[model samples]
Target: MTTQDLTNALNALSTGEHQNAIKGIKRGIERESLRIQSNGAISPTGHPKGVGSALTNGHITTDFSESLLEFITPVSESSTQTLKQLRDLQKFTLENMGDELLWPISMPCFINHQDDIVLAQFGSSNIGKMKTLYREGLKNRYGSMMQAIAGVHFNISFPESLWKSLHSLKQSNASLQDFISDGYLSLIRNFKRELWLISYMFGASPALCNSFLQGRKTDLPFKKLGKGTLYLEVGTALRLGNLGYTNSAQSSLRVMYNSLDEYVAGLKKAINTPSDIYSDIDDYTSEQPKQLNKNILQIENEFYSPIRPKRNANSGETPTDALLRAGIEYVEIRALDVNPFSEVGIDIEQIHFLDVFLTYCLLKDSPNMDWKEQARSTENLDAVVNQGREQGLMLNDNNTPRSLQSWGNQIFAQLTDVAKWMDKAYGVSYYSETIERMSMWVNDPSLTYSGRYVAKLKESGLDNGHFALELANKYKQSHIETDYSEFLKPWLEQQVEQSNEAQRNIENADAQSFTAFLDEYFHKN
Candidate 1:
């Protein structure tokens, strides 16, 4: 697709819109934060019963570790409402726990060793056991320290009306679901090309406590701060780089995104294919299974990506099956870092910017990316994650070296135009306001989150651990003083009981043996 193609698509969207098409966009968030003790050690307790059952609660759950809490919000079109829900959830959690504070940043603070991080647990049901075992396999494959790292996931689905308008504009003969899936794949491809910009702006894990690596070998140039803190002068998010959440074993699997069938086929192949590296670990037949299977990836979630095409799965249905069943429902953006600036990890300004950026991704024409382009895109992301704040940083745009400032300015111009259409839909200028404010950060490195975090540490003459603890305490105090706004205490109390009862029902309903359940889950239609 050319520039003219983008113009035509935008023109069609504006002229063909009906019944507030742009206002129909639905969004939700899954934010993760680790629970830490008063002195900044990882909490050793289980998921708090007052919070709800980790296995059944839709609003609150544990991610990889029992201490790493994940907060979810209900779907809404308004960013303001979504954030209000997020704040109340956090406030409720704070009210439940005695004094445990949520870790404010992506990289954890002052962990002793890998063994100290505990895996998340669910109750007696087989599915619950499988969830815990999946983390066991992760611990066996990668260490627990990597699992402790936290981030925010943004899930968004375009309004069905907007999809209808686009489908009509294309005038194609394919089904609506197929067209939607293809359009999302195109967005994924385009996002991969420009993800470095996100890491530069929102990435906050530029520095980390020395023990985070667990004394692993590395050659990256890391300079020391006041005490025990390791940092790179020009880094953006080390959590996104080679030092964090990276898998060297799955380097050979380049999953395709040009089509849903191809993407599913790629994941299925990885699931079924056995690996010599993982085969040595005890698997499904073991008395206590150490891993799910001997494959390169035990399950779909293990295959990490910055974004995934998502469809809410049914009971016993795998992620790939859900995609093949209904094409695609929405996109889960896994690239966002936990911004330390906000108590909720993500603020409305960021959400507004995301709305404009992702809509711009859909409106812009996206071309299919070959292997060479994909690899180049990864290289670009690596450069930004490591050296985004470097003075005179250059990024490769399809084999051409260009200044980051020039590329960022070009993208923001398109984003501002897209923001106008989005704002016109809701009779509000929030989208344009967010874009204009963020545009300045693109030009000035010091205004970015990573830059400000490093500056704060330096100005205070404190290490990463002390600085994080201060912020965690401050946010906790703020939450304690405020009353619940969106979700009241009465509603939250009712939800906790409902979630626990739901977990009990699932446990009582399980009659089949664990072996049979696993077999049927893999072989079912």
Candidate 2:
């Protein structure tokens, strides 16, 4: 599909119909943070009871460590509603945490040693044990410190009515689920190809404290700040590069997006394939297992990708099992950093822009990427993450090199029509406002999040740790002062009690041995 083709499709729809289509968009947010002390050190605090149980809480949970909290929102029809839900979560959490503040940056900077980070703890139920065991395997496979990095995941889906409209427009004969899954796969491919745009626009972690880089080697030259800070003058998001959620073993897995079957098969093979490296890490001959298995992957979620095709799993299903069982239900964008500039970690403008960009991804043509193209995509991503704002920077546009600015201009021009249509349909300027604001970043690199962060660091005369800590405290105080919705506080209180009861029920209901449970879990799908 071409730009003109998308414009024509939008033009074909009546205003009322377009309004309904726009209203069908579903969005959710999962924001992760590390609990930190006021003076900028990772907190060793336990999960607060007022925030609810990690095992059974639907909205709040722990990610990789005990201090790392992941706040989730229920699926909503509008970006405004989704953000409102996240705000309520933050307010409730701040009320629960006494003196600790949520770390505002994606790259953690205050750890003294890898041993200091505590692995997330869950209760003794079979499911909860498996969750913690998965994190333990991750820690053993990768260093515990590396797993402390935080991020924000945006989950998006389109209702069946919107897909039915597109299906009718294409006049396809494929089943609805297959058609939607294929469409999502295409979006994933396009997202991979163009992810550098997101990194360039929103990447914020340009510097880090020396503690995060302890006993590591680097090829790029970095400038020094106060005593402990080190930064690349033009680095966009170091967290998305070599230092962040990367695994050498999983890098060679070659999970393709050509089809749903191919993707599922790739993951299944990895889970079944034994790893010599992991096998040497632990001997599971004892009663307690060291890791889930000696395979390349403990589970499908171990494989890190900037974007994922997601399906809400049934009771005992893995992510791969869920996708295979019901096809792709939604796409989770895992590339976005924690934007410290915003109190909520993300803003309405960013969400609206993503809805527009993702819609464009669906309407645009995306060819299947082979191994070479995939490698090129990886190269493009690495370049943007390391030095996106460097002068005369270029990226691989399929095989040809193109200036990043030029390519961004081209995409933004196409998005204008999308923004206009959304504004007209919604009778508001939400989408148009983002396009207008973000277009300036394409023209002026200094306006980007990474650029502003570096400038602020220099102007404040504070090290990376101090600068982020200042913002964390500021946001914490802001959340504390802000009045929370009365309904939300009572709702959260009920959720806490309900989650604790649910965990108790699960503990009481487990009848099979854990070993037998593991065997069943691995074979059930």
Candidate 3:
């Protein structure tokens, strides 16, 4: 599809014929946060029992670390409803948590050592063991320090009606699933080129505990903050930069989204291709494995991208296989930092902006990006991650140097039109209002979340630890003050029991040995 395809689709949809389809754009959020002790250190406790088994609970689960809680909400059309579900999940967990507070920021709380961060245990089921083992591989490959950091994931999909309308508009002969997949790939390509704007606007990890570095780093030009914290004065999201979850292997990995076939083939090759560097991780003799296969990637999930084309895979299906089976169903955006200011970790304003920005991405002209272009896009994102608020930082835009502000403003200009279209589609002014509000951040950096967070840390005359500690306590108090009535309590209690039963069922259903299970899973058709 070219620029004219977008123009035709939008023009046709604007005539009110597909307003319901446009409004049916669905979204869900998977917000991750660390459970912290009262002193703001990463909690060493196991998953809270009241939240249910980390293995089988649909709403609540553990991420890489045992203390890192990931709360997921089901798909919803309304952002307000999604946020409400997210809040209910959090409030319910907090009510069950005994004196533990959810870390408000994306960067982790203080940990004395990497080993202090335990792998999230998922009971004794084969699938559960595989989940933990994959994380174990991550720890050996990249260390537990980076794995402890948290972020928010936004999952979105255009409705089937919208897809059907676009297909009809294009008059394409491709299968509907293939058309949907290609359209999402188009959106992914555009999102890659423009995701730097997201880091600039919503990033909130400008500062972190000095202990985070574990005393091995240099050359970031970070300033000391009140003795125990290190920070970049102009940094936007340090978590997205070199200091986050990265390794030397990732620099050499190239997983592209140019098409469904090319994307799947790239990942399939990575998982099957052995890595000389990783081969000797455990000598392949230990009863317990240190890493998964010593391959370039243990699984498709190991391929990290800011956004991914996704489908709801069945019980034993891989992500790529699921995509190959039914084409793309949705997209998962992994760029957002956990909002420190919001009790829910992400506010509706940000969601509104994302809806507009992502819709713009979907409706904009998208061309196939080659390896060189992907590298250029990566460089743009890294520049924004590191020096977004820097006074005159410029980025490479198709080899033409443009000031970050100018580039962002250009994107926002188009996003304004997208927002207007969305507003008309949804019958609300919030989308347009969100575009206007976010545009101010492009022209004025001080209003951005990371900028404001850094300013607050400085004004408080405290280290990152203390400032975060204050916010953690403040949010905990707010949760405490809100009456935790029993309306939501009984259902959660039932859910916990149900999830535990499900885990038992999974464990009971495991007829194969763990080794056979691993071999079968990796060697599955």
* Top candidate by TM-score: 1
* Highest lDDT scorer: 1
TM-score of each: 0.97, 0.97, 0.97
* TM-score of predicted structure 3: 0.97
Q: For model 1, how does the per-residue alpha-carbon lDDT over 70-133 read when each residue is reduced to its tens digit?
A: 9999998777888889989999998888889999999997899888889999998989988998
Model 1: colliding residue pairs: none
User: TM-score of predicted model 2?
Assistant: 0.97
lDDT tens string, model 3, 322-418?
9999999999999999999999899999989888888878877788999999999889988988889997889998889999988888787777777
What is residue 212's positional error in candidate 3, in angstroms? 0.7
Candidate-wise lDDT, in order: 0.88, 0.86, 0.86
lDDT of model 1, residue 338: 93
Q: What would the per-residue lDDT of candidate 2 be over residues 281-304, giving only the tens digit for each residue?
A: 552334766688889988888988
lDDT of 3: 0.86
Candidate 2 residues lying further than 4 Å off, grouped into runs, are 13-20, 283-285
Q: By descending lDDT, how would the candidates be arranged?
A: 1, 3, 2
Q: In model 1, where do residues sit more than 4 Å from their true spots?
A: 1-4, 16-20
Off by over 4 Å in 3: 1-9, 283-285, 483-487
In model 3, state the lDDT of residue 68.
95
